[model samples]
Target: MSHVHVPALASFLLAAGAAFGQAPIVGDIEGKEFRPFPIAVTELRLAPGAEAHKSAAQQLVKIVRADLELTGAFKVLDPKSFIDTDGLTQSTVRFPDWLNVGAAGLAKAQLKDEGSKLVVELHGFEVASAKEGLTKTVSGSKDDVRGLGHALADEIYRYFTGEPGVFRTRIAFVRKVQGEKHVFVTGIDGQGGGQVTKGGGLNLLPSFAPDGKSLVFTSYRLDNPDLYELALGDGSLKRVSSRPGLNTGGRISPDGGKIALTLSQDGNSEIYLLDRGGGLLKRLTSSWGIDTSPAWSPDGANIAFVSSRAGNPQLYVMGSSGGEPKRLTFQGTYNQTPAYSPRGTHLAFTARDERNVFDIFVLDLRTQKVARVTQDQGNNEEPSFAPNGRMLVFSTTRSGARQLVVSNLDGTKQTVITTGGEHSSPSWGPFVK
Candidate 1:
């Protein structure tokens, strides 16, 4: 399979923000030889007479530590190993103490209560340079204390990585409870999860709208495997596609102007392009074998999908406007569920090995190189890239029950976030503003 080169979409790079700034902490991420940087986060302190900040103070440190630990680029030290837990103030941080603890970076925070809200002051510093890297303040209602932690984590991440973190993003996944499958939404840390589909009979394959306020998924509520759009604002559900049979794998384009999905209304499983309102625009593939799991490139110029036209299920790349298809995978006998990274440099999917176990693999579009992301971990599948393109979320059965797992791009720092339920088909949502 050769790489397919297409003209660049002018507005692609500007979607996330201005051109992405170089990572403040540089390493060879593609080469997978970079060592994780040792970072230490001090326990959050509470202002005097602010007993209301007790719980939130503890939560702030927990969330920030978890977020940085998941990146794989940083090694968060245990708080018990800190010598100056309460003395590392913004103006008085002792970098020598952190360096003695084998940490190259240090983070400190303080929490205060204001009437009905909580305010947080966060700071980051380089242990080697002994210079402050970040100073910011975040505030939110005490009821939403977790949100403040996420905001502080994002600031710390940007201070050290230059790129924004997806701590504020959400994830949509399918969880089967008591033999019924329903769509559920959760924060990136797996906290604050609740069902989005209440009247659902069987809901699966959830794809978040680019705006992060809606989702497109396959449902059998009307006694058919039809597609439905779920509005998060009002819990409203509208049928997007109720064609004769097999309406599944619906993915909204990055620009939100089009949708590329698998439709079988024509008696053959194939990929089709649809307007945002579900009106058929054009059939992208007409194949005898199943062609499904269409993912849009960041530029919206190409789509990577799975098909069996090569005698076995493999990945294929084609133009979004309908054109000749080029195969993309040659190493795996079975490859499906292709997801294009937000950076447009790689495609992540699930591949089955000779031992009949499934794991995630990433394909470098530029070099046509395939790198295995998970192995010997109980059947990991359905990888979804975080908005930052530095992390991914997938479902794994390593704990004897399906759970959502988050990992870095190089397959390091894998952590299972969800503890209960049979969760699968996780899709990382876009950055929330």
Candidate 2:
């Protein structure tokens, strides 16, 4: 909020007192009352005598603040409330200054553009303990300085939350341009958005491999619905399944050993398992009704899918090896696009509420309770979880266009990830391995 200038300092001093405190960031958060941790992010300083990448420095801190706020667990204090802007050295930082502003945690960094890379020395502090929790130097190409900032945010997040952060992961979605749809990939924050497919046909349902190196989707390039895998490294396309009739709804397993998809070649749509190379491994569902949109659990022991067996499309979970299916949704007549969280506690999907409005909902697997993620917003659907399962990506029509939206798991906070395009069928990719 304020543009107070801070001199460059070598070391940061953290002060701890009992005046301000925050809830511990550990333990199970499911079904708990939401409480945001108060944190303050200081403007990053430029290293001594280093060429000032002013824009990069500002963007880096901005992104770090955004990444934390987007989690819905952090409340970033306004910069105007900061009382200490002087050079923060190990002995100069005053705990009372930050605690006065109601900040339980503080994050600071120094940026240096060293020709080939942008180097950053980042630090995290606890106000109550008056101690630094994280101090690390991270570097990245000048072209990807935002990534460096995200990496820093991840470290701070892990330091407090003891869990992995999703800032470095990516999301895949369908971006429509002039009636042509192509798969597009973007960072979790919507940076680096680029078309992954350039063919002259429709491409949809872009699902990433567990390794995050390739995307598998259904395409109409050959004038028939078929499955194809696109190598993200070299932009190479390989046809995975071109069987006669219908081939769609392809989802790769967590172990990368199999793919679960829908095949209507037998005059009836059913869920089927295929080897990584498209060979039919087994039939997962032989229901009389349409069964599609299969998603694998993190352990690869179960598959959550959509089925119309109960005379209405609903969510169902069955063993990956194929067995009696158990319905997982009863509150909605229409529930599809089930995405099991990697944390193994929730299943996010699109459900039509009683008002016939499509919204995103997350089912607590442990509690067997359904929580709505989107409400009163124009048709929000196709929920996909970030790698850490703390966030989700979906398409919303609330802004008058089918745009991509990123939100915390409960949907209390949301941010649009795309603008000026009709994007849908979003799938968050795994962390880069």
Candidate 3:
């Protein structure tokens, strides 16, 4: 396969505001080498002298603190280690008082009732300037306090990290147990691994829609790995496409109104972008090559993917609206599954070297240079950047079996997130709120 050269006219970039504020921004990446942030959080106060539900308020504080910690971007100051401020609220925080505890950021929230709904108000502030960073309210049924707390966490995440928070997003991945494989969607930290497919031959490769209400993934529910769309939340199901020979790759657009996937129904594996309602938007690749792993840009103007159009699999950039493609990577001989960062200046993918060891790599879209994030001797692939573009979650073989791993995008501070089971095809969810 040879590199496809696309024309420059089709290479238009989206506005920064769109990328900076966009939700569900998807791209490929693993560990970032950047520095981590440290912060503290405290329980919101019940009304003055109102002590009917102090425990519930305390639960909300713990949930908020844990949600931020799960992002891998923030290091929450341990509540046990800090002096207690159990009854603090959004209205009563003295900026200097909290700062003296050595926290760079602070989180304070309150629980209230607006008619029949339970409303949780959260505040994120910078310690130095005492300036409020972000504030938002979440409303839910009285029993849904946990949901409300997670929503507040999303607001706090957006406050410090300009991108949408995955606090409310759902992660879909393949889980294998007792020689059986199933696809699942759970909280960002693998908490909600709800099985989407069962009794599998191999249910791998799960991708959620931009709305996080649905998921499109490859499943062996039919005894052969085929593409299926499973509506989430209520778990309604639909079969998106099941081509004759292959149905293993599918990705939804950022707008939640389209899909780009690889299909062999046309007699060869090729990339196709389809509308939300199942209309063909465009055929991206028409070749005999194995053209899979299609990831749409935030603006939906182009796609970053891995194609074996060249003799060896490599990362390539092509017009999302249908035009010639351009090679985005040239350093590696085996680069598969190229995902464009939401910021459009970076790409994350899996690359193999002469020794046949695969590692996660991020490419600087502007300088056209490559940086390896996983230096361990084992195999690391399938890197998906967080919505903030600062960290990525990927699968690593370092844990003796394939398991989930997270780290800063710069390749430092690596943390193996999953303990048991064969977990692969890890897709970090979008801002949950």
Candidate 4:
């Protein structure tokens, strides 16, 4: 994939003699009541002599608008309601017209086609005070318009939320095709990626390494559920663990030096640690109950996994170096697939309720509070948090085909991002540099 080059076009400062200060944070992501910020993204303006790139410009605008809406933090206004189509310059933007359409912020961009690259000049404005808050220029290969769009979306997200965006990141999931299940990777928006595994293997539970260059998953290609690593750049495969029995749920540590996975070599399923090359490091759990699905915290200080030591499946947390495990969930009879947030403040997991329906829930480590993320829609499972920790990607049967869904922390904004197959076990990858 070609890299998107972003260079500063103008100083990232508010207009001189502006009437208002920096835009206040839209809403607290962790709060109960979240009011989406109203914003308008104007149609892309083609520079003089750049009319040939009109189709690309329209696609770029669609990508940015869709990305902003997917975050559930901004309500992108309809272009039909826009009263100002004069130009993209500061003097031509009518702040009163934007406010009249309930837009507190406005975004505009102009596209230019260079000899071998496409250039975009992006601008963000605060409608209330008519102050320009952001100005950037991004460029990429002529064939990589999507990359440029995602890069611009990331910049806009950072400008408003003071946090990095996951638009440029990727996600790995298992999709069944032609009677075989394989691992596939795609952009978080579920576009512009291809299958990562082949040879008719039943690959599952794919997780990304910290550097986002490769993935670790369990494949039954050899008649045993063994852990294998696939390089994203070259499609090369290497066996990481092939014990006598199950060796699944391979999750890399935050530092990218070790892996935590479930092993059943000792006659029972237990959590074990291994080096990147599949060498044994330590056995973290030894209980008779089945222990699996290990997840590492952001700081690599603790590991969370599911265990049945208490007679039922429950989530537990233990030191990465091996220690007594502490249970974290008590309300649900069955809870598994624990995924820690990027900030290590919460844990998202799958829980089965009294009605035998599985749903996703988040547990706040600080307040010991559990929040329901999905309900009554379908059987949702295997939630993976985005790099920003503000959203989640998981598989849901709400549409009767078991497609992947990306949802905000509150479940207020859920979007089906995949189709045409039964997708499951989503693992949201880290940001790509």
Among these predictions, the greatest lDDT belongs to 4
Q: After aligning candidate 3 to the native by TM-score, how far in Å is the CA of 268 from where it should be?
A: 4.1
lDDT of 3 by residue, 1-433 (tens): 1222222101211233245664311121123223347688876756543365577688778778777766556778876656544334445567666666777788776767565666666767777776675677767776766776777777776667555556666667787877878776676655545777755477778887877777788777776657777777777767776657776678888888788888787878888887765566777787667888998887878888777887878788888876788988777678887777766777888888767888887777776766677775489988887765666788889968888877665555577767777889988777654
- Steric clash pairs (candidate 2): 11-89, 12-89, 12-90, 13-89, 13-90, 15-130, 16-130
Whole-model lDDT, model 1: 0.83
Whole-model lDDT per candidate: 0.83, 0.81, 0.70, 0.86
Counting clashing residue pairs in each candidate, in order, gives 0, 7, 17, 0
Assess candidate 1 and give its TM-score to the true structure.
Answer: 0.93
Output the worst ten-in-a-row residue range by lDDT, candidate 2.
8-17
lDDT of 4 by residue, 165-251 (tens): 789999999999988999999998999998889897699999999999999999999999999999999999999999999999999
Clashes of 4: 0
Which candidate achieves the best TM-score against the true structure? Answer: 4
lDDT of 1 by residue, 1-433 (tens): 2222222211222232344665465333323346777888887878776776687788888888888887776888977888974454546776777888998888887777778878877778888888886778888888887888888888888877767878989999999978899999999888986999987489999999999999999999889899889999998888888998889999998899888888889899999998988999999998779999999998999999999998999999999987999999888598999999888888989988888788888887877777777887899999999998888899999889999999876675798989877999999999988
Better of 1 and 2 by lDDT: 1
Better of 1 and 4 by lDDT: 4
Candidate 4 TM-score versus the reference = 0.93
User: Of models 1 and 3, which has the larger lDDT?
Assistant: 1
